[model samples]
Target: MALYRGTGSGRLSRGLLLLLWVTLGSKLCPTGAIVQGANTSLAVPQNWTAHESATPDNKSQLPQFTLDDHYWLFAHFCWINFTIWMNNVTGAQLCDWRIISRPYSYLQYCLESAAEKLKFGYPNRIADDYIFKSHYIYFLNCTQDHPVLLDPPEDMLLALIIAPICLIPFLVTLVVCKSKDGKTQS
Candidate 1:
């Protein structure tokens, strides 16, 4: 039977096709491009004053966050530079483990402080810490005023479960498309 009828059944077929296209589009969406050669000072928001204004080595004293705005951001940076590619460390070498570790530890400390403030519910430390430091790393990494999404444990678990499922369907689509094209040509 025809997959796309010309009536109500056709509408259902169209909807499914549309949904498949949407899912595929979302999966293929590209991230923002790196700003090149444009006086790119680090884009940390000015309000995030929680960090220690010391040398890079002294960054350990920062009240850094654990997710540090998600380990993925750092991993993304790493892959953009020197992972499974040509061996020169040219692009962005800012994500060295030593550099990324301290501020994260500091964010943990800050989070603990916020948690203590939040434990009482309303008018407390969480709001108090919101001055600058609380969202420092988050704003630093995000583009424009968009909120940074931290990867919580659940996200990792969900990704682990969903990645293969998404891939299998895409692979199946490719095979089916190829089969249809082959049959039509022959």
Candidate 2:
């Protein structure tokens, strides 16, 4: 019976790990929408616009544009970076921008903020569209402004490939920790 219990426990752990992996992976994995560009420009939703700013500098400055909604903003940044990479710009050149300074810092901040605001519905889906449009415009403008400097030697796809692989172990650790604590001690 002890041997059977051990085997069952091992299987349970493996199953939990698998479940953790799938959930974490889905949550962490960039959604397909991350690649999709919005066709229309975003306008603050009706009534919601009253709280929004004509121009928002920082998250706090805007009344309607809560710090929570910044995820869309960060997504905009990633979309911009991804577009730049697709155009063949080097990560270093992209990083040269003060905004993109710390690796994934902008995205992390946006996600954290967005998570908080998810309940309010203040970050309407239109925000996503707005981000895409802005990114597309910025990308075109940058290329036009600096044709020579914009040309990158490295493959953007290669860099994207490396990102998730690097993240997997950290995710695994998180899952292990969660699993260990999830069960009650006798």
Instruction: Please provide, for model 1 over 58-122, each residue's C-alpha lDDT reduced to its tens digit, 9 standing for 90 to 100.
Output: 86644343433223222222222211121222334334445444444444444444344434333
Model 2 root mean square deviation, Cα atoms: 29.6
Lowest-sum lDDT 10-residue window in model 1: 79-88
Q: Which residue ranges in model 1 land beyond 4 Å of their true spot? A: 1-93, 117-186
Q: What total of clashing residue pairs does each candidate reach?
A: 7, 2
Root-mean-square deviation per candidate = 30.3, 29.6
Q: How many clashing pairs in candidate 2?
A: 2
Candidate 2, superposed: residue stretches over 4 Å from native:
1-42, 48-108, 120-124, 142-186
Model 2 gets an lDDT of 0.43
* TM-scores vs. true structure, each candidate: 0.18, 0.23
